[model samples]
Target chain A: MSLRERYGGMTRAEQGVSLFVCGFTALLVVALLTGGLTPSYTLYLAGLTGMYVLLSLGLNAQWGYTGLINFSVAAFFGLGAYGAALVTASNSPLAIPGGVLVGLVLAVVGSAVVATAIAIPTLRLRADYLAIASLGLAEVVRQIVLNQRDWTNGSGGLRGIPDVFAGWPVLGPLPGELPGLQFAEYAVGIPGLFRIRVLGFTLGEPFWTDLLNFVAVVVFVAAVYLLLRRVHRSPWGRVLRTIRSDEELASALGKDTYAFKLQSFVLGSVVMALGGVFYAYLVAYVDPGDLEPINTFYVWIAVILGGSGSNRGAMFGGFVVVAIREGTRFASDILPARLPVDVPVLVDVYGAIVSDFGSTRLLIVGLLIVLVMRLRPEGVLPPQRELLWPSALEETDE
Target chain B: MALLELLANGLVFSSIIVLASIGLSLVYSIADFANFAHGDTMAVGAYAALLAFGVIGGVGPTVLALPVGFFLSLAVGGAVAALVAVITHVLVYEPLEVDSIGLLITSIGVAFVYRAIIQLRFGSNPVEFGIPLQRPIDALVPLGIRITVHEIAIVASAAILVVGLHLLLQYTDLGRKMRATADNPSLARVAGIRTRRIEWWTWIIGAGLAGVGGGFLGLYNQLSPRMGFDILLVVFAAVILGGIGSVYGAMAGGLLIGVINQLMPAISNVAVALPLVPNVGPAYADTVAFLIMVAVLLVRPSGIAGGETT
Candidate 1:
């Protein structure tokens, strides 16, 4: 489809969002061309966004699809991260030598086990009970990590984590083996008036490694997305959606709703752990801070804002979350320079604000949640289309 | 011994938890949603009392090691919290036409907003009530209870508030209306009770108690932006332990949970005495409450009080 035709097909809100995204992408490209943003850092951001996308998708499976209020997103994510960290970190008390593969397996298994343990007691109760119970679980896990110095190194955090592809034969030394390429050596504009000197942006090992990580996440997201799309359009997915809308109705149909809910919970948690696994390799460090309840809410905001039950919306929400997080950091950086430093109190106040701008993000997250629930609870991109088996849908159409 | 000291400490702590739990339980029942912001409401109360205490500045004669002005500030804190909650109800919860779950999620947002505003205004660091710390009462110290006059004050004040609430619930016309509405909103409305008005009063009473509890919590521990949020789960455990909507049950649960929380070290010592049991540290105190809550859900979903509020 042509750009104009696709654009014409979109709703008004979609058109506006598309325009904003396009503009942002253009700005980012311009920055990259002008050597304003380092290639490695940009790629890092991309990988991080990809990780969030995975998280949102996982949440969508449980919340969007099944209507199970899983508040332990960060816990599962932490399980994934610590899974990888415990396996691969040089100072790991459990020095397992299976590299990233063991980490991935551990992440998935750990999340599933924890999810089951939490689900059995609360899943049979009211939905709000699950929310409260999951939150408690997150706290308990965090406490374990914070106190178990023998295993997790307590608050000191784990270090010397190898890259996601450290054990692979070809990819292990790939970044070091890649050739450096310089960009924009010559001026494109007027020779003298707006002479652009040698931009000379060199691609190094960091860029290559980040590029590999970004590629890995893209592949991971694509696989998960395809799997979700397939399942989401199946009869099983329909049952989940039915349960989300009315559990009584689904149960009346003789569907094992409790079993389905547990499956959904476990699957979503495993997906969330996958995000944490990627995060472990992306940052190459694991800390107790990763399990903060606030992190779970961030994914919550993403899923809800993007439109619950919509995979595409979840992807969009993840990007929006990263934008909000990094955007706040960017603003804090520039804010101090523009503020009046003449008055000592104002100076101190702004300094303090700029220093701890994470709370500013918290305020925004809070306001966004309240505003979204108040104004647009369906979210920005609520699932607009119905899901069904393609052949069945085609037959119906005929 | 140390066990007595811990028990005494637990009593003081339970007083704070009971106060907070009553508010949460009341709102949960009347509002028909888990108000996650209730803890933050307590924080709001504590911070407001902090500001009030700063303004009032120890002006009058002492009462239980706290100045009369401190009590006045505590009242101010409660009033401010109630007002904040009422405004939030009108502005946010009333206009929204979603189910209880939506409100629960929104309340989380409300919680973050409250914490964010506090953090913005007064960094994330812990602060004190500016009340002079007193020596442990000599008689109590001899009994192996090292609690101070301020600790005594907290328990006493909480008792007074709880008694007041009980009286208000059992005797008053408003209390009867509230009970009716909570029992069945549609029925209460048909009977010509203004359920909406009763709900507004519920917010007032619930948030008022929470604010007083928050102030006492500040006195018990250092006041921080996260002080209320930190204790939120413990209060939640209390509410769950007693049936969720039961006010009297919340009081009982809060007392038990609070005392248990303070007795963590003693419990750990006892565990060490056992052959196969590992010594769980005091850091896992909240975890124990959470486990108990889960166990309660498995055993008796209606709670120990059997969901009877009166």
Candidate 2:
């Protein structure tokens, strides 16, 4: 059946849920643009969340769509960030052409390379073994990044990397070369109007960068969403579902399940790499500490919370998770300072508590995952189809 | 003389590792999940021992602290284990009953929660207790490796615990029940064994042993929040090497890992002439353990004792 025909057959409830999701997303974007809820401090937080959403979607593509549990998303993301940072840095060979293109290529290629290296020995192993191996590999990658001071600058981290949109053309040339006209003079021309007249185009530096990043991220996400949607509706997607449902049966049907799984893994890893590039540009820094195992688990939580097999759900999950994290930070700021001691001791104690809470966000996230798993196994927005049951008993019963 | 001293010191270090690994192995075998919090359980035990030492003020408080620490840690560990079991069952394992993989991930979460709480309480700094033994050894025996009384105690205590555990598992009714449950949970349940209760007890005992190990380690090294994770690799390596379900294997494996960890540095130092091999020195012992784990897994995925479903 054609994609439209198949979608048309979906229940009204599903359609309603999709519509609500779209509405919520639109509302969030509008709020962000209009400065409704998020303030200056939280703008960075929102951007970070957007980056995570992108990463989570990549994970969902693998785990949610293909039933391949990747415990190394953080590593791939870090690699991408590092890749972009290294390439775009003033010292690197591929510093020109905006670094975005270079970063993208490097991330994709690097992810594929790492995936292939890991999959050769591990892909044939059992699921549990794969999990352990992937976790170990991630650690290995992290340690390598930490120890390789020459390449990654070791644990000291890579700083002073140029912003992706730093040197981009924000405004066009000025109309008629207004001689001796300062920026202040142009500023006073309009009240409540923040614009610079340059080459017939009026825009601010911050505005332009923000606009560029937003558009770039949206386009990337949209393209991925479309591609995933197409794949989900295709025969290839059906095969993937079959493999996830019953690997033996799919293999019996002459489907190279291992190859398909590897492809999914590599593809997802590549997408995560791109997310990492965005993250690097957003933060303007890349550090080994930023890419911890907990980060990968956070993405897992996001994808699962959103609805594993649903691309849109993964995106939504990312947004919610990031929002909650930022919201917690904002909440912490508003909280009354309650200390049991006085002066220096009080400051020390309060600071310790605050930092402890900050670090323990992962612990809370873990607890949330547990709650979500127990309460909603199918996730917030489960896949449209009932995927394969692993056992023969389940198959016959169904 | 210095070399002899280093060897003695290494042996002492190995003994502590062996104790820690044995406890971890028992838990892995019986509990069927790697308790990432196993290390913290050790830290908790060490702190408990420190508390005991503080309470019983005397010249020989360190020596006396052992039993107090052991018993206190046992109590604390057992209680915590039982609590974790119930919480895990309710929150993580129950929901994804069919998915063992999900349970594994949940265990990781549970481990993180335990770790965070510990970090929150302890503040990530290393807590040290003053050593009671001043003179490491007497001059009576010639060519003897001078060792601290505390180190001596650690070795002696580890031996006693290992033997005690071996005897307990082999001889007692509770031990037999535990074995039955570990062997076949469903079958044991059908055969009138309270498998859940058995599992609870297993956690308690396992965690308690870890606590005891931790207490001893506290005496040997410093107690930090990351101490558990730091030693986790070595412990797991030992467990896997010894055999997943076999207590004896764990003990042997622990001892073996301990020896390798201690000796590798000496060997590396001696090979300073080798251009390619930089002397890893004492600082990178954890790195050595990590490498060993990778090697073991690559060489033998079934582990030394083989996989125990329980």
Candidate 3:
């Protein structure tokens, strides 16, 4: 009962067409989000969404594809960020100069190490136990980072993470003649377009760090999306799906379910670590506060809400979460201006209340999670099960 | 002896854990899912007690009516906590049904909502019963050992609650029905046992104890929105160690963990006292429950008191 067993997977031509449409739509959304409403802030949000897209994609690989109840997203992400920090930050304990590429490698390696160590023993546990174990381990990871004062600087948080692209020869010089803040370059050529202003808006480009980091993120996200789509459609994806649907059946068929589960877990963690590295590089800072357990839950929410098994769905969920979380910051501007004849006293109270509407946003997110799971448990973008080979069902129906 | 001090401290914490873990285990056994929000139930209890005290504290005569007022606040706290816990199960969890993963995730949502509500209401700072607190009961003892009145009170109350629960489970017909439902719900239902009613009672008792535990815990530790979360993790450690479903196992396991949380840190502090070892700091001690939970789970995933494993 495979989609491949019915209709062969989407043809290359079909895939090409769909990819173009998705890309075009993504571009339009990016434009809408980045223009007029709060360009710099919107850019920051976009960069963050890209980072989370990677995280959710990683979670999708583990939970949606393999049915492993891995709750180590925050741990792996923190490790990645700290891993990057160790190599790249000015006061880092390590000797490595902050070459962005080297930091990424360290993050991926560090995440893999922790993932392997945690998975070796706990992978044998039932799903609920695994959840507990992973969650506990994540706390252990956070505690270790905090308590190991000599190593992690006692939670003051590492600073001065070198910008990965600011020093590049050609593109680095593009933001030339800037003073004080080295990264914020002035507008050029495009006049009003480049020099556009909004609340707290700066012209020309986002922090060169954000620009380069986001570019790098886009590249990574594109590569990962393409790669996941390929793997998800391949025979390997079939095996993972088999394990997800029925581990015993997969094991019975000699799929080595344990090994596969571990692989899926490590794979997901590695991707998440890469996200961590990107996040650290984009922000140019690392802190234990950035790696709370709540952040991991956010990634899981994104994956489940978007579409658990679908890479594109994961990205969509990432967008929705970031918009809800970050979009609220600019609500006063966008929301207040649009309101008709607001009561003066109530409006003042509303303004005061909306100043700290963070919990309000999360409440909505949480309510949406309950509602979505209750109504559309499969998510907004459920995974399509098209087959690689022409399916027998399709042929018979034809 | 320092050992006695640690033992007192251990017993106090263990009793609280005992109070909390029994409910956690009960839910895990009969309902068949790790109730992630169980810890929040404890927080709700403590905060509810705090609220009740705030309302009732001013009305009572200071000398004659304070104790009565305190007990009333405690009851109010426990009841409110239990009510909220039941509401969570009904509104959030029961809707998810047998989709355990979905229920689990939804519980995480519920935890966030609970924590956010507490934060919004109480703010981020820790709150306590501002009344001048008592010194250790062993304060007057000549052995140079100290155990606070709060500690003694916590331990005594825990013991009473444990005994009361034991008696209820062992001597009562409802207890038999609960045990039967927990053991085999389908079979109990076929035998004309009201399994759903038993489940309601199970949640009620579990949440009520959790609330009571929280109320008492706030007396010992300063109450905060995060108090339940930290305690809940440790309670989970105890529950898993005791074997998930077994009530007796959870009690013993809580005592074991409570001791380890306190006594082991005391031992480590002593070690640090000896000149050779450097100071690892108190935060290092927090990892014990997590380590023990993982290590115990590795050796005996079914726990020391084997619970249902499916």
Which predicted model would earn the best TM-score? 1
User: Which 10 consecutive positions of candidate 1 chain A have the poorest summed lDDT?
Assistant: A332-341
lDDT of 2 by residue, A172-261 (tens): 222122233223212223657664332222334444455556667777777877787777667887888788778999999999998888
* Total backbone clashes of candidate 3, pairs 3 or more residues apart or in separate chains: 7
Candidate 1 residue A138 C-alpha distance from true site, Å: 1.0
Query: What 10-residue stretch in candidate 2 chain A is worst by lDDT?
Result: A180-189
Model 3 gets an lDDT of: 0.79
Q: Interface RMSD values for the candidates, listed in order?
A: 1.3, 2.9, 2.0
Worst 10 residues of 3 chain A by lDDT: A179-188
A1-398, model 1: which lDDT tens digit per residue?
A: 89999799788768877887778778777767776667887788889899999999999999999999988899999999999999999888778778889989988998899899988878997899878888888899999999998889889888898887876999989999999876746567775668554466888888888898899999999999999988888889989999999999999999999999998898899999999999999988889999999999999999999898988889889989998988898787667543564786787666656778888899999999999999999888888653655577569768
Q: Candidate 1: which docking quality band?
A: medium
Residue by residue across B175-287, what tens digits does model 2's lDDT show? 88888877777888899999777766776677667766776677678877667666766777677677667777777778777877777667677768688886565655655
Better of 2 and 3 by TM-score: 3
Candidate 2 docks at the CAPRI level of: acceptable
Chain B alone, candidate 1, TM-score of 0.98
When 1 and 3 are scored with TM-score, the better candidate is 1
Instruction: Kindly state the fnat score of candidate 3.
Output: 0.43
Model 1 segments more than 4 A misplaced: A185-199, A336-355, A386-398
* Angstrom error at residue A142, model 1: 0.8
